[model samples]
Target: MRYHTVIAWAAAAGLLAGAAGRGYLAPLLPPDEGHGAWYASRAAGISAYLFLWLSLAGGLLMSSAWFDGLVNRARLLAAHQAFAIAGLALGLVHALVLIPDGWTDFGPADLFIPFASYYERADAALGTIALYLFAIVTFSFWFRGAIGPATWRWVHRASFVAYLAALWHGIRIGTDTGALPVAVLYLLTSSLLIGALTVRLVYVRPRRQAPARPPSRAAAEPAG
Candidate 1:
């Protein structure tokens, strides 16, 4: 759960950077009048930022799968689902905002498919895939009982895919891609997540052999 906390905090920071301050509060910065063509790129940046934040928060909540506490797990999963929906919603906002201009500018094809589209198509494509994956996994939880444990588990595994894509989406398009702060944050959070899982994999494994106690001559003599 400590790991989860890390994910949540990181995600919150990312979201606020792109959504809370970047998008809504475009305060005193000089306007980029020359880069008028980069509107789609800007929108993609906002979406990717928000998506990473939501995914981080969701990931923190998801680390509860290892918990033995039922109520706690449920609470965390609920939070995870909620943030994922927020990510999806923001992604749609990103897409919709582009619609009015994308068609006339780059033709309709670039908006849906990736790589072949406009400048920001990569991030947009990743966001779209992550959104669909989030929807499937989130919705499947409601039918958990009907699907039974195995199938439900498989469905939920899609969460990781969504998370990875969302993270990649953000890193690939963020204006701060090369910034020291962003790089430090990304490396620190990623290392923390991977490190914790590694510790569990190595140090937390079940004991396979009894500790070797020296064969004491005294104990052997006493037994005789």
Candidate 2:
């Protein structure tokens, strides 16, 4: 089977599973009783962040020679792509599940459009923007051939911006950001990604120029 086909199926499966889970839990834990949608959104948001982190980390590893012998590049690339797709899927679920939450009053425009939400508009916008950026970067994989390698690389760099936006969004607006464990998770993951990127930048060797062919004996003897 083709790689793109697998990615499409995986994304579809993820969305279906998320929708089913939300449907099952929504009735049992009503908004008045426990705010199930809110909880689900938080969980999905955190999971998506973690998946994005993994995808970025894997991409850094793929570009750097540090893991060349230790890890299989092909597998690393596959994992990176898979994680990115999973992250995008979970991100959509994170936002979509919130539609049922009565507390926030998040309409489709508020959830999908940046700065459209009245509640914590700036912070929520960051998350919304991050989601869109993630989508662009993830889908760019499918169009890499058409866009050309240079453009594809530049598009992939948008992941860094997406990561930053997500981190900021979570820290500023996340309900559980105050918790020690969640704070620690955010700190640790961001630190690891920064470290990996540093290694990639510092250790990535430039292409070596071909050595100039030594001058022939005749040329050396009588240069003209």
Candidate 3:
């Protein structure tokens, strides 16, 4: 547990440093005709999406019984949690980087509040909603006990909704999608998510049948 906590803190620090360096420090150097900011935002956004995909895939793998022998369920769950938190951090950088980029008039409201920005309002709103949903889903882990098993499960399902919203947002608003490599990346991630969901839904184990009750005393006496 201590080790995991340390890892979490380290990951958080790294994310903050990376975001700050990319957003503030890099911009201090000579400008590259605004390409610096553009490229940084694009790269961060793409990385965010990749992290989110990994997190989703990890969760799916952990939930399914398919990996029974190959990996321990507990370890898989730990990694799932790590990936989810890291993905959320990367996502914050992805949106925050845009503020310093100056390419878009994305003020604080635009980034945090859904549909606040006029630029690609619908798509941006999707991303914004996704961000909040992801945060909620991640935090739900700490409150899982209080929330109860059923409610925790219901809240976790929001991750899928968040993932879909993010995917749509990236497809519509992402500039890198035009490139062959990035496009292929998007396709592969989407395919994996869909395939995992299909497997989970189709291959889930049926509930065990309850044992039959024995005959009551009265019924047995009458027969006797």
Candidate 4:
């Protein structure tokens, strides 16, 4: 199957599954229950979105491999930004829907505040961090002429941190996963994607750019 097909299906299925799961739990979850349900809904929605955005990032990053056949690096970068921005819009929706829950204090500091969650506060912090990173990377989109490529590249590199943090945050809390196959999904798709991306960054991409190593001293010394 085409790469995009698998990505499309996974994202769609994750989204539908999360919505269905939350709806099924709604009647059981107290209408006045603490902010947890809001978080659950957001997590599910975001999970679906994460897959979608990552698929886009992956596709665009590797676009040279397929689709347009590596013709346009700048165009691929633009595609990535488009997908990421759409995902960010959905994420904002997730946050806005959850905001009225009256959970924690909402302030600029809380946006970066970490380890304060009595429930899943740390996890929330992680997600918030991811959101911020996304914002930074995409800032160049709006201010490309001003943001130079070097600074822009650094911001984009932080995306992996956001991805990992969000993934870790999602499955760790959220009561829905009690018997909801959360572990399986967490390990299989989320973790796998993270692992693959990390591996690609460390081992695959850098090997090409590494400067040529001079002949080993042992070799130059004539192997004794």
In candidate 1, position 164 carries an lDDT of: 72
Model 3 scores a TM of 0.78
lDDT of 1 by residue, 1-224 (tens): 25465446446644654665466645523375654334544554454444544554445434534443444665555455555555555555555555565333544465556566666777757766776777787677669999998999888777668767766866786665576756775676566656545544455323369889987888777653
lDDT tens per residue, model 4, 1-224: 24464345445544654676567645655455577737655554545445445643564336324434445654555445555655665555555565445665554344445655445677767766777777776555456568787776676667767666666666565454564455566566665665555555555332237788899877888553
Off by over 4 Å in 1: 1-19, 22-74, 102-109, 114-124, 174-176, 180-185, 195-224
Candidate 4 residue pairs that clash: 64-70, 117-121
Q: State every prediction's TM-score relative to the real structure.
A: 0.58, 0.79, 0.78, 0.56
Model 4's C-alpha root-mean-square deviation from the true structure amounts to 10.6
lDDT scores of the candidates, listed in order: 0.58, 0.84, 0.77, 0.56
What is the C-alpha lDDT profile of model 3 across 124-163, one tens digit per residue? 9999898889889877888998999999999999999999
| lDDT leader | 2
lDDT of 2 at 84: 82
Q: Per the 3 Å backbone cut-off, how many clashing residue pairs does candidate 3 have?
A: 0
* Candidate 2 lDDT over residue span 30-84, tens digit each: 3545677787888789878988888889899789877877887776777778788
Clash counts for the predictions, in order: 0, 0, 0, 2
Lowest-scoring 10 consecutive residues by lDDT in candidate 3? Answer: 1-10
Give the C-alpha miss distance for residue 170 in model 1, angstroms: 3.0
How would the candidate models be sorted by lDDT, starting from the highest?
2, 3, 1, 4
Winner by TM-score between candidate 4 and candidate 1: 1
